[model samples]
Target: MKYVRKLPATDRQLSNQLIENGWKKIKEPRNFSLAVLFSLPFSYLLGSIILWLAYLLKPTLFEFLISDVLSISFSIDFKMLLYILFVFVYMLIHELIHAVFIPNFTKSKKIFFGLNGLFGFVFTTEPIKKERFLVISIMPFFLLSLVPVFLLNLLGFLNWYTLGLCLINAVGSCVDFLNMFLIAFQVKSGHTIINNGFETYYYPMQNIT
Candidate 1:
Protein backbone atom coordinates (compact mmCIF):
# COMPACT_ATOMS: atom_id res chain seq x y z
CA MET A 1 0.00 0.00 0.00
CA LYS A 2 1.08 3.67 -0.52
CA TYR A 3 0.75 6.78 1.68
CA VAL A 4 1.32 10.40 0.62
CA ARG A 5 2.13 13.48 2.69
CA LYS A 6 1.87 16.99 1.21
CA LEU A 7 5.04 18.84 1.95
CA PRO A 8 4.80 22.35 3.34
CA ALA A 9 6.46 25.35 1.68
CA THR A 10 9.92 23.90 2.34
CA ASP A 11 11.80 21.39 4.48
CA ARG A 12 12.82 24.22 6.79
CA GLN A 13 9.22 25.18 7.33
CA LEU A 14 8.36 21.62 8.14
CA SER A 15 11.42 21.28 10.37
CA ASN A 16 10.58 24.46 12.23
CA GLN A 17 7.05 23.28 12.82
CA LEU A 18 8.40 20.04 14.16
CA ILE A 19 10.98 21.75 16.36
CA GLU A 20 8.38 24.02 17.86
CA ASN A 21 6.54 20.90 18.95
CA GLY A 22 9.61 19.09 20.38
CA TRP A 23 10.68 17.19 17.30
CA LYS A 24 14.30 17.32 16.22
CA LYS A 25 14.90 15.98 12.74
CA ILE A 26 17.94 13.77 12.99
CA LYS A 27 19.81 12.18 10.12
CA GLU A 28 18.61 8.74 9.26
CA PRO A 29 20.97 6.07 10.45
CA ARG A 30 23.31 4.80 7.75
CA ASN A 31 22.19 1.38 8.90
CA PHE A 32 19.90 0.19 11.68
CA SER A 33 22.62 -2.29 12.57
CA LEU A 34 22.57 -1.46 16.27
CA ALA A 35 18.81 -1.77 16.36
CA VAL A 36 19.03 -5.12 14.61
CA LEU A 37 21.86 -6.21 16.81
CA PHE A 38 19.76 -5.73 19.93
CA SER A 39 16.53 -7.02 18.41
CA LEU A 40 17.68 -10.36 16.92
CA PRO A 41 18.60 -12.23 20.06
CA PHE A 42 15.86 -10.38 21.85
CA SER A 43 13.26 -11.79 19.48
CA TYR A 44 14.57 -15.32 19.83
CA LEU A 45 14.72 -15.03 23.59
CA LEU A 46 11.25 -13.57 23.87
CA GLY A 47 9.84 -16.05 21.40
CA SER A 48 11.44 -18.87 23.32
CA ILE A 49 10.02 -17.64 26.61
CA ILE A 50 6.56 -17.37 25.12
CA LEU A 51 6.78 -20.84 23.61
CA TRP A 52 8.00 -22.26 26.88
CA LEU A 53 5.13 -20.70 28.77
CA ALA A 54 2.66 -22.13 26.29
CA TYR A 55 4.22 -25.54 26.66
CA LEU A 56 3.99 -25.32 30.43
CA LEU A 57 0.44 -24.09 30.44
CA LYS A 58 -0.95 -26.86 28.24
CA PRO A 59 1.65 -29.24 26.96
CA THR A 60 -0.79 -31.99 26.12
CA LEU A 61 -3.53 -29.74 24.82
CA PHE A 62 -1.06 -27.74 22.72
CA GLU A 63 0.46 -30.87 21.27
CA PHE A 64 -2.88 -32.48 20.57
CA LEU A 65 -4.38 -29.35 19.12
CA ILE A 66 -1.54 -28.82 16.70
CA SER A 67 -1.46 -32.45 15.72
CA ASP A 68 -5.18 -32.77 15.16
CA VAL A 69 -6.34 -29.44 13.89
CA LEU A 70 -3.33 -27.98 12.12
CA SER A 71 -2.76 -31.54 10.80
CA ILE A 72 0.89 -31.25 11.56
CA SER A 73 2.83 -34.09 13.11
CA PHE A 74 3.51 -33.31 16.75
CA SER A 75 7.00 -31.97 17.30
CA ILE A 76 8.63 -29.10 19.19
CA ASP A 77 9.91 -27.68 15.92
CA PHE A 78 6.46 -27.59 14.31
CA LYS A 79 4.92 -25.84 17.28
CA MET A 80 7.73 -23.28 17.23
CA LEU A 81 7.02 -22.61 13.56
CA LEU A 82 3.37 -22.05 14.27
CA TYR A 83 4.22 -19.63 17.09
CA ILE A 84 6.63 -17.55 14.98
CA LEU A 85 4.36 -17.41 11.94
CA PHE A 86 1.40 -16.36 14.07
CA VAL A 87 3.32 -13.54 15.74
CA PHE A 88 4.94 -12.33 12.50
CA VAL A 89 1.64 -12.10 10.59
CA TYR A 90 -0.08 -10.36 13.47
CA MET A 91 2.67 -7.72 13.78
CA LEU A 92 2.91 -7.25 9.99
CA ILE A 93 -0.74 -6.28 9.73
CA HIS A 94 -0.35 -3.91 12.67
CA GLU A 95 2.42 -1.99 10.87
CA LEU A 96 0.56 -2.08 7.55
CA ILE A 97 -2.38 -0.35 9.19
CA HIS A 98 -0.04 2.52 10.09
CA ALA A 99 1.12 2.75 6.47
CA VAL A 100 -2.41 2.82 5.07
CA PHE A 101 -3.50 5.59 7.42
CA ILE A 102 -0.68 8.00 6.46
CA PRO A 103 -2.15 9.07 3.12
CA ASN A 104 -4.64 11.18 5.03
CA PHE A 105 -1.78 13.50 6.02
CA THR A 106 -0.07 14.50 2.75
CA LYS A 107 0.48 13.43 -0.84
CA SER A 108 4.09 12.63 -0.04
CA LYS A 109 5.19 9.99 2.41
CA LYS A 110 7.94 7.38 2.60
CA ILE A 111 7.87 3.91 4.20
CA PHE A 112 10.79 1.63 4.98
CA PHE A 113 10.46 -2.09 5.69
CA GLY A 114 13.16 -4.14 7.38
CA LEU A 115 13.53 -6.53 10.26
CA ASN A 116 14.49 -5.04 13.60
CA GLY A 117 15.49 -8.50 14.63
CA LEU A 118 12.22 -10.45 14.43
CA PHE A 119 10.15 -7.24 14.85
CA GLY A 120 9.67 -4.38 12.40
CA PHE A 121 8.11 -0.90 12.01
CA VAL A 122 6.60 1.06 9.11
CA PHE A 123 7.48 4.72 9.70
CA THR A 124 6.38 7.86 7.84
CA THR A 125 8.65 10.78 6.99
CA GLU A 126 5.90 13.39 7.00
CA PRO A 127 5.61 15.94 9.79
CA ILE A 128 2.26 15.48 11.50
CA LYS A 129 0.89 17.56 14.33
CA LYS A 130 -0.13 15.87 17.57
CA GLU A 131 -3.85 15.49 17.16
CA ARG A 132 -3.61 13.66 13.86
CA PHE A 133 -0.78 11.57 15.25
CA LEU A 134 -2.94 10.21 18.05
CA VAL A 135 -5.23 8.75 15.45
CA ILE A 136 -2.40 7.32 13.39
CA SER A 137 -0.62 5.63 16.31
CA ILE A 138 -3.67 4.38 18.20
CA MET A 139 -5.78 3.21 15.27
CA PRO A 140 -3.68 0.16 14.43
CA PHE A 141 -3.70 -1.16 17.98
CA PHE A 142 -7.44 -0.74 18.34
CA LEU A 143 -8.59 -1.71 14.85
CA LEU A 144 -5.95 -4.20 13.78
CA SER A 145 -4.32 -5.58 16.92
CA LEU A 146 -6.92 -5.80 19.66
CA VAL A 147 -9.90 -6.43 17.42
CA PRO A 148 -8.10 -9.34 15.77
CA VAL A 149 -7.41 -10.88 19.15
CA PHE A 150 -11.10 -10.89 19.97
CA LEU A 151 -11.92 -12.56 16.66
CA LEU A 152 -9.01 -14.97 16.83
CA ASN A 153 -10.10 -16.03 20.32
CA LEU A 154 -13.42 -17.12 18.92
CA LEU A 155 -11.59 -19.26 16.40
CA GLY A 156 -9.26 -20.49 19.11
CA PHE A 157 -12.17 -22.09 20.95
CA LEU A 158 -12.69 -24.24 17.88
CA ASN A 159 -9.03 -25.06 17.13
CA TRP A 160 -6.05 -25.42 19.44
CA TYR A 161 -3.56 -23.89 17.05
CA THR A 162 -5.90 -21.00 16.59
CA LEU A 163 -5.93 -20.55 20.36
CA GLY A 164 -2.16 -20.56 20.37
CA LEU A 165 -2.11 -18.09 17.52
CA CYS A 166 -4.50 -15.81 19.38
CA LEU A 167 -2.28 -15.87 22.43
CA ILE A 168 0.66 -14.76 20.34
CA ASN A 169 -1.45 -12.03 18.76
CA ALA A 170 -2.39 -10.61 22.13
CA VAL A 171 1.18 -10.62 23.36
CA GLY A 172 2.50 -9.15 20.12
CA SER A 173 0.58 -5.97 20.75
CA CYS A 174 3.12 -5.01 23.41
CA VAL A 175 5.12 -3.17 20.79
CA ASP A 176 2.06 -1.21 19.73
CA PHE A 177 1.28 -0.46 23.33
CA LEU A 178 4.74 0.94 23.86
CA ASN A 179 4.58 3.01 20.70
CA MET A 180 1.24 4.46 21.67
CA PHE A 181 2.42 5.26 25.17
CA LEU A 182 5.61 6.96 23.99
CA ILE A 183 3.74 9.09 21.48
CA ALA A 184 1.07 10.00 23.98
CA PHE A 185 3.67 10.97 26.54
CA GLN A 186 5.52 13.04 24.02
CA VAL A 187 2.29 14.74 23.09
CA LYS A 188 1.66 15.54 26.72
CA SER A 189 5.08 17.07 27.23
CA GLY A 190 3.78 20.34 25.77
CA HIS A 191 6.17 20.22 22.86
CA THR A 192 4.26 20.35 19.57
CA ILE A 193 1.04 22.17 20.27
CA ILE A 194 -2.02 20.74 18.59
CA ASN A 195 -5.67 21.07 19.49
CA ASN A 196 -5.87 21.11 23.32
CA GLY A 197 -2.09 21.34 23.68
CA PHE A 198 -1.33 17.89 22.29
CA GLU A 199 1.93 17.71 20.36
CA THR A 200 3.42 15.10 17.97
CA TYR A 201 6.97 14.89 16.73
CA TYR A 202 7.83 14.05 13.11
CA TYR A 203 10.66 12.05 11.58
CA PRO A 204 11.19 13.69 8.18
CA MET A 205 13.89 11.49 6.71
CA GLN A 206 12.01 8.35 7.74
CA ASN A 207 8.66 9.54 6.37
CA ILE A 208 7.03 7.53 3.62
CA THR A 209 5.66 9.85 0.98
Candidate 2:
Protein backbone atom coordinates (compact mmCIF):
# COMPACT_ATOMS: atom_id res chain seq x y z
CA MET A 1 0.00 0.00 0.00
CA LYS A 2 0.99 3.63 -0.41
CA TYR A 3 0.48 6.80 1.57
CA VAL A 4 -0.40 10.25 0.28
CA ARG A 5 -0.40 13.55 2.10
CA LYS A 6 -3.89 14.36 0.97
CA LEU A 7 -6.41 12.09 -0.66
CA PRO A 8 -7.48 13.06 -4.17
CA ALA A 9 -10.93 14.39 -4.96
CA THR A 10 -13.81 12.05 -5.73
CA ASP A 11 -13.37 10.78 -9.25
CA ARG A 12 -16.73 11.41 -10.87
CA GLN A 13 -15.35 10.47 -14.26
CA LEU A 14 -14.26 7.12 -12.89
CA SER A 15 -17.67 6.67 -11.31
CA ASN A 16 -19.28 7.38 -14.66
CA GLN A 17 -17.04 4.92 -16.42
CA LEU A 18 -17.94 2.22 -13.88
CA ILE A 19 -21.60 2.90 -14.59
CA GLU A 20 -20.96 2.50 -18.29
CA ASN A 21 -19.21 -0.75 -17.57
CA GLY A 22 -22.48 -2.02 -16.01
CA TRP A 23 -21.38 -2.00 -12.40
CA LYS A 24 -24.15 -0.71 -10.13
CA LYS A 25 -23.77 1.83 -7.37
CA ILE A 26 -24.28 0.90 -3.77
CA LYS A 27 -26.03 3.10 -1.19
CA GLU A 28 -23.92 5.91 0.23
CA PRO A 29 -24.66 9.22 1.88
CA ARG A 30 -25.18 11.73 -0.94
CA ASN A 31 -23.33 14.47 0.91
CA PHE A 32 -21.47 15.12 4.14
CA SER A 33 -24.62 16.67 5.59
CA LEU A 34 -26.57 13.47 5.04
CA ALA A 35 -23.55 11.49 6.18
CA VAL A 36 -23.62 13.16 9.56
CA LEU A 37 -27.34 12.61 9.85
CA PHE A 38 -27.14 8.94 8.93
CA SER A 39 -23.95 8.12 10.78
CA LEU A 40 -25.12 9.28 14.21
CA PRO A 41 -27.46 6.34 14.71
CA PHE A 42 -24.85 3.84 13.67
CA SER A 43 -22.25 5.40 15.91
CA TYR A 44 -24.57 5.43 18.87
CA LEU A 45 -25.76 1.89 18.35
CA LEU A 46 -22.29 0.48 17.81
CA GLY A 47 -20.88 2.37 20.75
CA SER A 48 -23.68 1.14 22.95
CA ILE A 49 -23.13 -2.42 21.90
CA ILE A 50 -19.40 -2.17 22.49
CA LEU A 51 -19.83 -0.64 25.92
CA TRP A 52 -22.55 -3.08 26.86
CA LEU A 53 -20.44 -6.09 26.00
CA ALA A 54 -17.34 -4.52 27.45
CA TYR A 55 -18.84 -4.16 30.92
CA LEU A 56 -20.70 -7.42 30.63
CA LEU A 57 -17.44 -9.28 30.16
CA LYS A 58 -15.71 -7.26 32.84
CA PRO A 59 -17.72 -4.86 34.93
CA THR A 60 -14.57 -3.09 36.00
CA LEU A 61 -14.27 -1.16 32.71
CA PHE A 62 -17.71 0.32 33.10
CA GLU A 63 -17.01 1.16 36.74
CA PHE A 64 -13.69 2.69 35.81
CA LEU A 65 -15.17 4.74 32.99
CA ILE A 66 -17.88 6.06 35.20
CA SER A 67 -15.81 6.55 38.34
CA ASP A 68 -12.34 7.30 36.98
CA VAL A 69 -12.34 8.59 33.43
CA LEU A 70 -15.39 10.67 34.18
CA SER A 71 -14.40 11.87 37.62
CA ILE A 72 -10.61 12.01 37.46
CA SER A 73 -9.19 15.45 38.04
CA PHE A 74 -7.45 17.18 35.14
CA SER A 75 -3.74 16.44 34.94
CA ILE A 76 -0.89 16.35 32.43
CA ASP A 77 1.47 13.41 32.86
CA PHE A 78 2.98 10.53 30.87
CA LYS A 79 -0.31 8.65 30.49
CA MET A 80 -2.03 11.85 29.42
CA LEU A 81 0.63 12.55 26.86
CA LEU A 82 0.39 8.99 25.64
CA TYR A 83 -3.35 9.31 25.35
CA ILE A 84 -2.95 12.45 23.26
CA LEU A 85 -0.46 10.83 20.91
CA PHE A 86 -2.60 7.68 20.79
CA VAL A 87 -5.62 9.66 19.67
CA PHE A 88 -3.76 10.76 16.53
CA VAL A 89 -2.14 7.39 15.94
CA TYR A 90 -5.45 5.60 16.32
CA MET A 91 -6.69 7.01 13.03
CA LEU A 92 -3.69 5.69 11.16
CA ILE A 93 -3.92 2.25 12.76
CA HIS A 94 -7.64 2.10 12.07
CA GLU A 95 -7.11 2.71 8.36
CA LEU A 96 -4.20 0.32 8.27
CA ILE A 97 -6.43 -2.48 9.58
CA HIS A 98 -8.75 -1.67 6.73
CA ALA A 99 -5.90 -1.71 4.19
CA VAL A 100 -4.66 -5.08 5.38
CA PHE A 101 -7.97 -6.84 4.71
CA ILE A 102 -8.41 -5.19 1.35
CA PRO A 103 -8.11 -8.00 -1.22
CA ASN A 104 -4.84 -8.09 -3.14
CA PHE A 105 -3.58 -5.07 -1.24
CA THR A 106 -0.06 -6.38 -0.88
CA LYS A 107 0.20 -7.12 -4.61
CA SER A 108 -2.09 -4.54 -6.19
CA LYS A 109 -0.21 -1.40 -5.25
CA LYS A 110 -3.57 0.35 -5.73
CA ILE A 111 -4.31 0.80 -2.06
CA PHE A 112 -3.47 4.09 -0.37
CA PHE A 113 -3.79 5.56 3.10
CA GLY A 114 -3.95 9.25 3.95
CA LEU A 115 -5.90 12.07 5.42
CA ASN A 116 -8.95 13.45 3.68
CA GLY A 117 -9.69 16.66 5.46
CA LEU A 118 -10.11 15.58 9.09
CA PHE A 119 -10.32 11.83 8.55
CA GLY A 120 -7.69 9.22 7.86
CA PHE A 121 -8.86 6.68 5.24
CA VAL A 122 -7.78 3.84 3.03
CA PHE A 123 -8.70 3.86 -0.65
CA THR A 124 -8.35 1.29 -3.37
CA THR A 125 -9.76 0.74 -6.82
CA GLU A 126 -9.73 -3.03 -6.47
CA PRO A 127 -13.00 -4.90 -6.73
CA ILE A 128 -13.78 -6.88 -3.57
CA LYS A 129 -16.31 -9.64 -3.10
CA LYS A 130 -19.26 -9.18 -0.80
CA GLU A 131 -18.20 -11.69 1.83
CA ARG A 132 -14.64 -10.38 1.82
CA PHE A 133 -15.70 -6.76 1.69
CA LEU A 134 -17.94 -7.29 4.69
CA VAL A 135 -14.90 -8.52 6.62
CA ILE A 136 -12.86 -5.55 5.42
CA SER A 137 -15.50 -3.12 6.57
CA ILE A 138 -15.95 -4.46 10.07
CA MET A 139 -12.60 -6.03 10.94
CA PRO A 140 -11.16 -2.81 12.29
CA PHE A 141 -14.10 -2.48 14.66
CA PHE A 142 -13.26 -5.81 16.24
CA LEU A 143 -9.49 -5.59 16.08
CA LEU A 144 -9.12 -2.01 17.21
CA SER A 145 -12.19 -1.36 19.32
CA LEU A 146 -13.50 -4.53 20.85
CA VAL A 147 -10.41 -6.72 21.00
CA PRO A 148 -8.33 -4.27 23.01
CA VAL A 149 -11.04 -3.77 25.59
CA PHE A 150 -11.91 -7.43 25.79
CA LEU A 151 -8.31 -8.54 26.05
CA LEU A 152 -7.43 -5.94 28.64
CA ASN A 153 -10.51 -6.61 30.69
CA LEU A 154 -9.84 -10.33 30.51
CA LEU A 155 -6.28 -9.70 31.65
CA GLY A 156 -7.52 -7.43 34.45
CA PHE A 157 -5.71 -4.22 33.50
CA LEU A 158 -7.87 -1.14 32.97
CA ASN A 159 -6.20 1.96 31.57
CA TRP A 160 -7.34 5.09 29.81
CA TYR A 161 -5.35 4.45 26.63
CA THR A 162 -7.11 1.19 25.78
CA LEU A 163 -10.43 2.59 26.87
CA GLY A 164 -9.87 5.67 24.78
CA LEU A 165 -9.02 3.46 21.84
CA CYS A 166 -12.18 1.51 22.52
CA LEU A 167 -14.53 4.45 22.86
CA ILE A 168 -13.11 6.65 20.09
CA ASN A 169 -12.82 3.86 17.56
CA ALA A 170 -16.41 2.86 18.24
CA VAL A 171 -17.54 6.30 17.14
CA GLY A 172 -14.82 6.67 14.53
CA SER A 173 -15.85 3.48 12.73
CA CYS A 174 -19.40 4.67 12.29
CA VAL A 175 -19.15 4.59 8.50
CA ASP A 176 -17.68 1.11 8.41
CA PHE A 177 -20.48 -0.20 10.61
CA LEU A 178 -23.02 1.56 8.43
CA ASN A 179 -21.48 0.16 5.28
CA MET A 180 -21.42 -3.34 6.71
CA PHE A 181 -25.15 -3.17 7.38
CA LEU A 182 -25.89 -1.61 4.00
CA ILE A 183 -23.91 -4.24 2.15
CA ALA A 184 -25.36 -7.09 4.20
CA PHE A 185 -28.97 -6.08 3.66
CA GLN A 186 -28.85 -4.50 0.23
CA VAL A 187 -26.36 -6.52 -1.77
CA LYS A 188 -26.72 -10.15 -2.75
CA SER A 189 -24.11 -12.67 -1.70
CA GLY A 190 -21.42 -13.80 -4.18
CA HIS A 191 -21.30 -10.34 -5.72
CA THR A 192 -18.38 -7.94 -5.75
CA ILE A 193 -18.18 -4.34 -4.52
CA ILE A 194 -15.95 -1.62 -5.88
CA ASN A 195 -15.91 2.12 -5.77
CA ASN A 196 -14.93 5.09 -7.87
CA GLY A 197 -13.60 7.51 -5.37
CA PHE A 198 -16.60 7.98 -3.04
CA GLU A 199 -19.12 6.39 -5.35
CA THR A 200 -19.39 2.66 -4.53
CA TYR A 201 -20.49 -0.09 -6.88
CA TYR A 202 -21.32 -3.80 -6.71
CA TYR A 203 -21.60 -6.39 -9.44
CA PRO A 204 -22.17 -10.11 -9.58
CA MET A 205 -19.01 -12.17 -9.80
CA GLN A 206 -20.51 -14.16 -12.66
CA ASN A 207 -21.47 -11.04 -14.55
CA ILE A 208 -18.91 -8.28 -14.30
CA THR A 209 -19.81 -6.27 -17.38
Candidate 3:
Protein backbone atom coordinates (compact mmCIF):
# COMPACT_ATOMS: atom_id res chain seq x y z
CA MET A 1 0.00 0.00 0.00
CA LYS A 2 2.85 2.33 0.97
CA TYR A 3 6.37 2.59 -0.27
CA VAL A 4 8.73 0.51 1.81
CA ARG A 5 11.14 2.66 3.78
CA LYS A 6 13.59 -0.13 4.34
CA LEU A 7 13.97 -3.77 3.50
CA PRO A 8 13.20 -5.94 6.50
CA ALA A 9 14.66 -9.37 7.29
CA THR A 10 11.81 -11.10 5.51
CA ASP A 11 12.38 -8.92 2.50
CA ARG A 12 15.97 -10.00 2.49
CA GLN A 13 14.89 -13.62 2.29
CA LEU A 14 12.54 -12.90 -0.56
CA SER A 15 15.24 -11.04 -2.40
CA ASN A 16 17.62 -13.90 -1.91
CA GLN A 17 15.21 -16.37 -3.44
CA LEU A 18 14.69 -14.05 -6.36
CA ILE A 19 18.41 -13.65 -6.94
CA GLU A 20 18.90 -17.40 -6.87
CA ASN A 21 16.31 -17.71 -9.58
CA GLY A 22 17.96 -15.01 -11.77
CA TRP A 23 15.36 -12.41 -10.93
CA LYS A 24 16.64 -8.87 -10.51
CA LYS A 25 15.47 -5.89 -8.49
CA ILE A 26 15.30 -2.39 -9.93
CA LYS A 27 15.17 1.13 -8.57
CA GLU A 28 12.26 3.41 -9.35
CA PRO A 29 13.09 6.48 -11.38
CA ARG A 30 13.37 9.74 -9.50
CA ASN A 31 12.10 11.53 -12.60
CA PHE A 32 9.72 9.94 -15.08
CA SER A 33 10.56 12.16 -18.07
CA LEU A 34 12.04 9.43 -20.21
CA ALA A 35 9.28 6.99 -19.43
CA VAL A 36 6.73 9.62 -20.34
CA LEU A 37 8.49 10.55 -23.54
CA PHE A 38 8.59 6.95 -24.63
CA SER A 39 5.28 5.58 -23.45
CA LEU A 40 2.72 8.39 -23.80
CA PRO A 41 3.01 9.09 -27.49
CA PHE A 42 2.99 5.43 -28.42
CA SER A 43 0.07 4.62 -26.17
CA TYR A 44 -1.94 7.59 -27.40
CA LEU A 45 -1.24 6.96 -31.04
CA LEU A 46 -2.11 3.32 -30.76
CA GLY A 47 -5.19 4.07 -28.70
CA SER A 48 -6.42 6.59 -31.25
CA ILE A 49 -5.97 4.22 -34.14
CA ILE A 50 -7.81 1.41 -32.41
CA LEU A 51 -10.71 3.64 -31.33
CA TRP A 52 -11.07 5.11 -34.80
CA LEU A 53 -11.30 1.70 -36.34
CA ALA A 54 -13.85 0.57 -33.83
CA TYR A 55 -15.88 3.71 -34.40
CA LEU A 56 -15.90 3.36 -38.17
CA LEU A 57 -16.64 -0.32 -38.39
CA LYS A 58 -19.23 -0.66 -35.64
CA PRO A 59 -20.71 2.78 -34.94
CA THR A 60 -24.34 1.67 -35.05
CA LEU A 61 -23.67 -1.50 -33.09
CA PHE A 62 -21.63 0.30 -30.45
CA GLU A 63 -24.27 2.99 -30.05
CA PHE A 64 -27.11 0.58 -29.65
CA LEU A 65 -25.29 -1.66 -27.22
CA ILE A 66 -23.91 1.07 -24.94
CA SER A 67 -27.28 2.87 -24.87
CA ASP A 68 -29.09 -0.25 -23.78
CA VAL A 69 -26.74 -1.23 -20.94
CA LEU A 70 -25.64 2.08 -19.41
CA SER A 71 -29.23 3.40 -19.67
CA ILE A 72 -28.30 6.66 -17.98
CA SER A 73 -29.63 8.85 -20.79
CA PHE A 74 -26.87 11.40 -20.22
CA SER A 75 -25.17 13.57 -22.82
CA ILE A 76 -22.35 11.97 -24.76
CA ASP A 77 -19.75 14.18 -23.06
CA PHE A 78 -20.99 13.32 -19.58
CA LYS A 79 -21.00 9.65 -20.39
CA MET A 80 -17.47 9.93 -21.73
CA LEU A 81 -16.33 11.53 -18.49
CA LEU A 82 -17.82 8.71 -16.47
CA TYR A 83 -16.17 6.17 -18.69
CA ILE A 84 -12.80 7.84 -18.12
CA LEU A 85 -13.45 7.83 -14.39
CA PHE A 86 -14.20 4.14 -14.53
CA VAL A 87 -10.92 3.54 -16.32
CA PHE A 88 -9.06 5.35 -13.57
CA VAL A 89 -10.81 3.26 -10.93
CA TYR A 90 -10.09 0.09 -12.85
CA MET A 91 -6.42 0.94 -13.12
CA LEU A 92 -6.26 1.52 -9.39
CA ILE A 93 -7.92 -1.81 -8.73
CA HIS A 94 -5.41 -3.52 -11.01
CA GLU A 95 -2.51 -2.02 -9.07
CA LEU A 96 -4.06 -2.90 -5.74
CA ILE A 97 -4.20 -6.49 -6.81
CA HIS A 98 -0.44 -6.39 -7.35
CA ALA A 99 0.12 -4.83 -3.93
CA VAL A 100 -2.11 -7.27 -2.05
CA PHE A 101 -0.84 -10.35 -3.83
CA ILE A 102 2.86 -9.67 -3.21
CA PRO A 103 2.71 -9.63 0.61
CA ASN A 104 1.98 -13.33 0.60
CA PHE A 105 5.54 -14.04 -0.55
CA THR A 106 7.60 -10.90 -0.10
CA LYS A 107 8.55 -9.04 3.04
CA SER A 108 8.80 -5.62 1.53
CA LYS A 109 6.23 -3.80 -0.57
CA LYS A 110 6.71 -0.45 -2.24
CA ILE A 111 4.36 1.27 -4.61
CA PHE A 112 5.05 4.30 -6.79
CA PHE A 113 2.26 6.26 -8.40
CA GLY A 114 3.03 8.99 -10.89
CA LEU A 115 2.29 10.27 -14.36
CA ASN A 116 4.65 9.78 -17.25
CA GLY A 117 3.52 12.71 -19.39
CA LEU A 118 0.00 11.61 -20.26
CA PHE A 119 0.53 8.00 -19.18
CA GLY A 120 0.15 6.98 -15.55
CA PHE A 121 1.25 3.85 -13.70
CA VAL A 122 1.58 2.07 -10.35
CA PHE A 123 4.54 -0.22 -9.77
CA THR A 124 6.22 -2.18 -6.98
CA THR A 125 9.76 -1.31 -5.92
CA GLU A 126 10.40 -4.65 -4.30
CA PRO A 127 12.40 -7.29 -6.10
CA ILE A 128 10.60 -10.47 -7.02
CA LYS A 129 11.24 -13.75 -8.75
CA LYS A 130 10.64 -13.94 -12.48
CA GLU A 131 7.63 -16.15 -12.01
CA ARG A 132 6.08 -13.71 -9.58
CA PHE A 133 6.89 -10.81 -11.84
CA LEU A 134 5.24 -12.50 -14.78
CA VAL A 135 2.14 -13.32 -12.78
CA ILE A 136 1.76 -9.78 -11.51
CA SER A 137 2.39 -8.30 -14.92
CA ILE A 138 -0.34 -10.34 -16.57
CA MET A 139 -2.96 -10.34 -13.83
CA PRO A 140 -4.22 -6.79 -14.46
CA PHE A 141 -4.86 -7.35 -18.14
CA PHE A 142 -6.63 -10.65 -17.66
CA LEU A 143 -8.79 -9.64 -14.74
CA LEU A 144 -9.30 -5.94 -15.32
CA SER A 145 -9.09 -5.55 -19.06
CA LEU A 146 -10.00 -8.75 -20.86
CA VAL A 147 -12.81 -9.76 -18.54
CA PRO A 148 -14.38 -6.31 -18.44
CA VAL A 149 -14.27 -6.00 -22.21
CA PHE A 150 -15.80 -9.41 -22.67
CA LEU A 151 -18.58 -8.72 -20.19
CA LEU A 152 -19.37 -5.32 -21.67
CA ASN A 153 -19.48 -6.81 -25.13
CA LEU A 154 -21.67 -9.65 -23.97
CA LEU A 155 -24.18 -7.20 -22.50
CA GLY A 156 -24.79 -6.23 -26.15
CA PHE A 157 -25.97 -2.67 -25.84
CA LEU A 158 -24.10 0.56 -26.34
CA ASN A 159 -24.83 3.97 -24.91
CA TRP A 160 -22.56 6.96 -24.51
CA TYR A 161 -21.41 5.82 -21.07
CA THR A 162 -20.79 2.19 -21.93
CA LEU A 163 -19.11 3.19 -25.18
CA GLY A 164 -16.78 5.48 -23.30
CA LEU A 165 -16.19 2.85 -20.66
CA CYS A 166 -15.38 0.28 -23.29
CA LEU A 167 -12.86 2.59 -24.91
CA ILE A 168 -11.28 3.37 -21.57
CA ASN A 169 -11.07 -0.31 -20.84
CA ALA A 170 -9.41 -0.91 -24.16
CA VAL A 171 -6.85 1.81 -23.58
CA GLY A 172 -6.10 0.56 -20.10
CA SER A 173 -5.69 -2.95 -21.42
CA CYS A 174 -3.37 -1.72 -24.16
CA VAL A 175 -1.00 -0.26 -21.59
CA ASP A 176 -0.88 -3.57 -19.78
CA PHE A 177 -0.57 -5.49 -23.01
CA LEU A 178 2.55 -3.59 -23.96
CA ASN A 179 3.96 -4.18 -20.50
CA MET A 180 3.31 -7.91 -20.66
CA PHE A 181 5.21 -8.14 -23.89
CA LEU A 182 8.22 -6.31 -22.50
CA ILE A 183 8.35 -8.47 -19.40
CA ALA A 184 7.89 -11.69 -21.32
CA PHE A 185 10.30 -10.79 -24.11
CA GLN A 186 12.96 -8.49 -22.75
CA VAL A 187 15.77 -9.62 -20.49
CA LYS A 188 18.08 -7.55 -18.33
CA SER A 189 20.54 -5.68 -20.45
CA GLY A 190 23.27 -4.32 -18.19
CA HIS A 191 22.20 -1.83 -15.50
CA THR A 192 19.78 0.09 -17.70
CA ILE A 193 16.15 -0.96 -17.22
CA ILE A 194 12.60 -0.06 -18.22
CA ASN A 195 9.48 -0.47 -16.04
CA ASN A 196 7.10 -0.86 -19.04
CA GLY A 197 4.27 0.64 -16.97
CA PHE A 198 3.21 -2.71 -15.62
CA GLU A 199 5.80 -4.77 -13.69
CA THR A 200 8.67 -5.42 -16.09
CA TYR A 201 12.04 -4.99 -14.37
CA TYR A 202 14.99 -3.81 -16.37
CA TYR A 203 18.07 -3.65 -14.19
CA PRO A 204 21.24 -5.40 -13.19
CA MET A 205 21.32 -8.05 -10.49
CA GLN A 206 22.40 -6.74 -7.15
CA ASN A 207 25.40 -8.65 -5.91
CA ILE A 208 24.52 -10.06 -2.50
CA THR A 209 27.56 -9.91 -0.32
The numbered model that scores best in lDDT is 2
lDDT at position 205, candidate 2: 81
Which whole-number lDDT from 0 to 100 does residue 43 have in model 1? 43
- Enumerate clash totals for all models, in the order shown: 20, 0, 9
Model 2, residue 179: C-alpha shift (Å)? 1.4
Cα lDDT of all candidates, in order? 0.49, 0.79, 0.50
- TM per candidate: 0.48, 0.85, 0.51
Worst 10 residues of 1 by lDDT: 190-199
Q: Which lDDT tens digits does candidate 2 get at residues 121-161?
A: 88887878888888888888899888887788778764655
Scored by TM-score, the top model is 2
lDDT of 1 by residue, 160-208 (tens): 5554554454455444444455556544432332211122244323332
Stretches off by above 4 angstroms in model 3 are 3-31, 40-59, 62-85, 103-121, 157-160, 173-178, 188-209
Q: Local error of candidate 2 at 139, Å?
A: 0.5
**Worst lDDT window (10 residues) for model 3?**
190-199
TM-score leaderboard ranking? 2, 3, 1
